[model samples]
Target: MTNPTPGQTVSGTITVAANATDNVAVSSVQFLLDGQPLGNPVTAAPYAASLNTTTSTNGAHTLSAKATDPSGNVGSAAGIAVTVQNPTPPMTCFVLQTSVTARGTGTVQTGAFSTVISGEVLLAFVSMDGPGGAAGQSATVSGAGLTWRLVGRANSRSGDAEIWTATASTVLHNVTARSAPAKGGYAQDLTVVAFEGATGTGAVSTGGAASGAPTLTVTTTAATSLVLAVGHDWDKAVARTLPTGFAMLDQCVDTAHGDTSWSEYTNQATGPAGTPVKIGATAPTSDQWNMAAVELLNSGS
Candidate 1:
């Protein structure tokens, strides 16, 4: 055998067993799965084939090996079955930033600060890599005032891509690490929302009161917020980082779209370390209350 299994995703080679009579030379080794060929027969010295397994499906696979000898003669070969298992996704690394500076978990600081979680999406084109995207991606927030949101797609914008949005107003945006490794782990950018007032849903625009005054109405309270001025700790991950060498960047929100409010940002609290930032809706619309998007980046070979 020339090659062993790479964690259950490969099969060993067939070394045409040596025979003293006539230097028994093997014409070729055949591989079959339930009487089906997995790949072309290996004619070279090192006879082995890699198993094509992915995250979507992976498990024990029965494989049969048959060798053909010289002289119009076929010898009885031993049947060997090999198992193929699913390969794990890669873990790609990326830069982790926060909407608000002041590191640490909590007590580091407070206020309506935007934790701008920014990172570059690495593009990788490898056949062995797993799928990469925001299908199972998400984010969260914590503290006395904070909101989370997802926006944009990975590898779609420059380094300054605003993929995540943080709504702060007493509630704090907590940072979440990847739970699993994606295709080498994808690069991502997330912003934590913090410190804000009552959250409103639906639409609100200026000069809509017929008297040049701003007035809006919401049909569902699920898309509104009441707090404001919260700090953020973006770079929060949900499922896992992009595949190794492949990262995704974008944004998301925690409490839906808590932007459309009467006071919008009337009293946006101060940021930690004396920095100033605020989150509010500008001329409310149906989207200002709830919005989200995810961008994934593919890495190169």
Candidate 2:
């Protein structure tokens, strides 16, 4: 009897023999598996059997070889074990991140965002960090803005939406993640990152990439000092007059946010000798400036 190999459809042969009585003619041979007859083999002295390919998997099978000689003499042989193995399949996976920073603040802000197609998060790095501070951090998360608290977690979220809000008082957020159903498709990431907006500046670039995964880069621009002015009711013990290298670069004829009035300004292009200084300052009150919301630029490019 003939059969395919364990994993494949194989062919096998069975031999029949007869004593020198009469020229033995063949009667029939049978193929069996697991004590059941597979099929009839009624050809020549050497009989063959065929096995189906579908029946084989990643295991072993038993095939029996039984035959009858022309003399009507029948004999059965024990089945042999045949093994078939399946081929291993290939694998697949993906990643997504930001190459740009948040718009409001000059500093770059990035983290894993959710998928547009399935709402799955390829990455989720949002929320705030450090000591207790959330009131001033109440940001309007547009794409999916999360509120920051003292620790690196969200105190609450301003909101999320498919459409953009147009209010100047409202801060808008956009997605940083690639949609699972739209383009890239790895949605199990949950690494959150948020930037407390304070007018910092910088650029972004994809950092190092994982061996087979992708990396994202987000950069921003920011300044260490803001060109602002204030009165000398400023305390030296509680708060010193900037304590260091900071001079009024400009001043305003009026006030806006309750601080002393001032407009945005920069140093004179040519030299420090001609650098602009804050005007209208008297003794007890000094025209001054200091690191402006400088922490926001920590991730600056």
RMSD of each: 22.9, 29.8
| Cα lDDT tens digits for candidate 1, 1-301 | 2122222242222212111122567776665554666577655433444444342134555455565667745543344444443343332211222223222221123233222111122111100111222222222223333243333222211111112333332211233321111323322222232211112221211111111112222222121221121111112111221212222222222222121111122221122222222232232222211122222221210
What is the per-residue lDDT of model 2 for residues 111-163, given as tens digits with 9 covering 90 to 100?
53322111112112221111222221212222344322211112221111010
TM per candidate: 0.22, 0.22
Off by over 4 Å in 2: 1-23, 86-301
lDDT of 1 at 148: 30
Global fold similarity of model 2 (TM-score): 0.22
lDDT of each prediction vs. the true structure? Answer: 0.27, 0.27
